[model samples]
Target: MAEVLVLYYSRHGGTRKMARLIARGIESTGAVATLRTVPELVVAGETATPQQADDPFVTLDDLKNCDGLAFGSPVRFGNMAAPLKHFIDSTSKEWLAGTLIGKPALVFTSGSMLHGGQETTLQSMMLPLLHHGMVIVGLPHSEPALHSTQGGGSPYGPSHITSESRRQPDNDEKDLAIAGGKRLAMIAAKLQER
Candidate 1:
């Protein structure tokens, strides 16, 4: 099966939940999805050693081996969170080797408010992957949820708006995520066929 790496850094579990649902969508398309997370990065306190969370920490090898990628993060001032950024910055060797070139990619994010920079966070994640020469994947208007989602679904990628009163994504958001994952997996599988 084609393997797609699903990587993310989530603080309040919103991004993590979206990642899981996306992975499910990938699997539904007969592709394998490897879920991975980054370590917490803090500047002031005792710097904690890197450790695995519920999902194992991603390695350069994951990038080299995966047929596709799904990168997600929480919004930090309309950008990707620092922990995820740190990990991406460390992939210089991989980038130099063109490890991810021609691979398919998807990006996702979660925001605390309805208007909270989710698209920008997704774009921030896409920038590095674009430099790595990955073909970015996106949701299409054909997806019914995209036309009507009020929580968080975008043509750029799947997103969740965890507003002040909400944590879990609504049905529309979840469906979009799954559709995006499925679309990514299908594209990856098609590419592998060549």
Candidate 2:
């Protein structure tokens, strides 16, 4: 079976929840979704500890082996969190190897407020994937949730608005996430067939 890597960094469980939902969507299409998270970057002189409660830290091998990728992060001032950016910055070897070239990739994010840079964070995550020559997959308007979602759903990718509280994603957000994941898997499968 083809594998889709669902990589993310979650500070307060919002992004993590989105990642699992996306993985479920990926699996619904019969694709294996390998979920991974990056380690937290500790400040100098600070004690380094595992930030992720249980998810394995992502490795270069995950990037090389997966047929597709779904990157998720909590919005940090209109951008992806530091840990995910740090992890991607370390992928020079993979870039040189062209491991991700032509692979289908998508991005997702969660933020504290409705206007809190969710779309920009998604776009920011796509920059690295584009540099690696991967094809970008986005949620299209055809998804009904995109038209009806009052919480979070965008043409760039699925997103969640976690204003004031880290509430569970609303039904519209969930459906859009599932649709994006399924769309990514279907595209990956088609690419593999060619």
Candidate 3:
């Protein structure tokens, strides 16, 4: 089966949760979604710590081989988390090869406050993928939740803004994430079949 890579970096688990929901949506389209997380970067001579057992690190080959992509991260001051940035920075080889060219892609993010830069973070994540010549797929206004939700859905992409003190994805946000994933997968599948 074709696989869509659901790649993310989540420090407090909120972004991870979003990744899972997107993966579910991808699978619902009958395309496989491979969940991969980046390991925390430890500087040389700094203490190396293990990431959570379940959140295994992503390798560059995973990025190169996936049929499509769904990237998620926690908002870090109006941007994606540093760890995810670091991972993307290491993908120059793929960029040079144009390995991701024409692939379908989607972005998702989790933020602490309703205005905590969710849209900006989603846009920020798109920059690198755009540079790779990947085609971006975002939430369309056709999704009723995008119009009705008071929080966290954007035409740029799906997003989650945490209202509670603890950052977590709400139901509407998850629905948007999944919807975005499904949209991406459907586009990719059609392109592949063509």
Candidate 4:
């Protein structure tokens, strides 16, 4: 089966929830979704073990092998959180090897407020994927939820407005996320056939 890696770094569970919803969308298209999370970055000389949480730590192999990618992160000051960035920065080897070239990829984020830089954060996450030559997948205006969402949905990607709270995403947000995943899967499958 074609496999799409749903990789993320979530704190306070909002982004993690988004990742699951996206994975559901991916699987609805009959593609296998491999969900993985990265460990929190530790300071040098610190002996901290990474937390597994709902998903295990992601390895480079996951990036190299996946047919598609859906990346998620909590927005931090108009950017992805350091943990996810740290992980992406470590993928120079993958970039050099061209392992992710031509794969379809999407990005998602959760922010504490409605104006909390959701679009910018999603764009920031796409940078490394673009460098790796992955095709960035985004929601089009045709997605109905994008027209009426009071919470979060964007042309850039699916998003959630957490208000910095732990509440679950609204229905509109969920629908957009699922749609984005399914779209990514369909595009990936088509590309893989080329």
Q: Write the per-residue lDDT of candidate 3 for residues 68-178, one digit (tens) a residue.
A: 999998899999888899999999999999999999999998877888898899999999999999999988888988877777889988887774564666677878988
Over the stretch 1-194, how does candidate 4's per-residue lDDT look in tens digits?
67999999998899999999999999999999999998887869988885757998899999988999999999999999999999999999898999999999999999899998999999999998999999999999999999999998899999999863448999999999999999999999999898
- lDDT by residue (1-194, candidate 1, tens digit) is 78999999988899999999999999999999999999998778677676548899898888889999999999999999999999999999999999999999999999888788988888999999999999999998999999899889899999999956798889999999999999999999999999
Which segments of model 2 are wrong by more than 4 Å? 44-46, 164-166
Candidate 2 lDDT, 64-183, residue by residue in tens: 889999999999999999999999999999999999999999899998899989999999999999999999999988899999988888999999998555489999999998888998
The list of candidate 1 runs beyond 4 A from truth reads 45-52
RMSD of each: 1.5, 1.3, 1.9, 1.8
Which order, best to worst by lDDT? 4, 1, 2, 3
Q: What is the lDDT of residue 46 in candidate 1?
A: 75
Judge candidate 4 at residue 100 and give its lDDT.
96
When summed lDDT is taken over every stretch of 10 residues in candidate 4, the lowest stretch is 160-169
Q: Which residue pairs does candidate 1 place in steric collision?
A: none
**lDDT, model 4, position 43:** 69
TM-score of candidate 1 relative to the true fold: 0.96
Residue clash pairs of candidate 2: none
Instruction: Give residue 13's lDDT in candidate 3 (0 to 100).
Output: 76
What TM-score would you give candidate 2 relative to the actual structure? 0.96
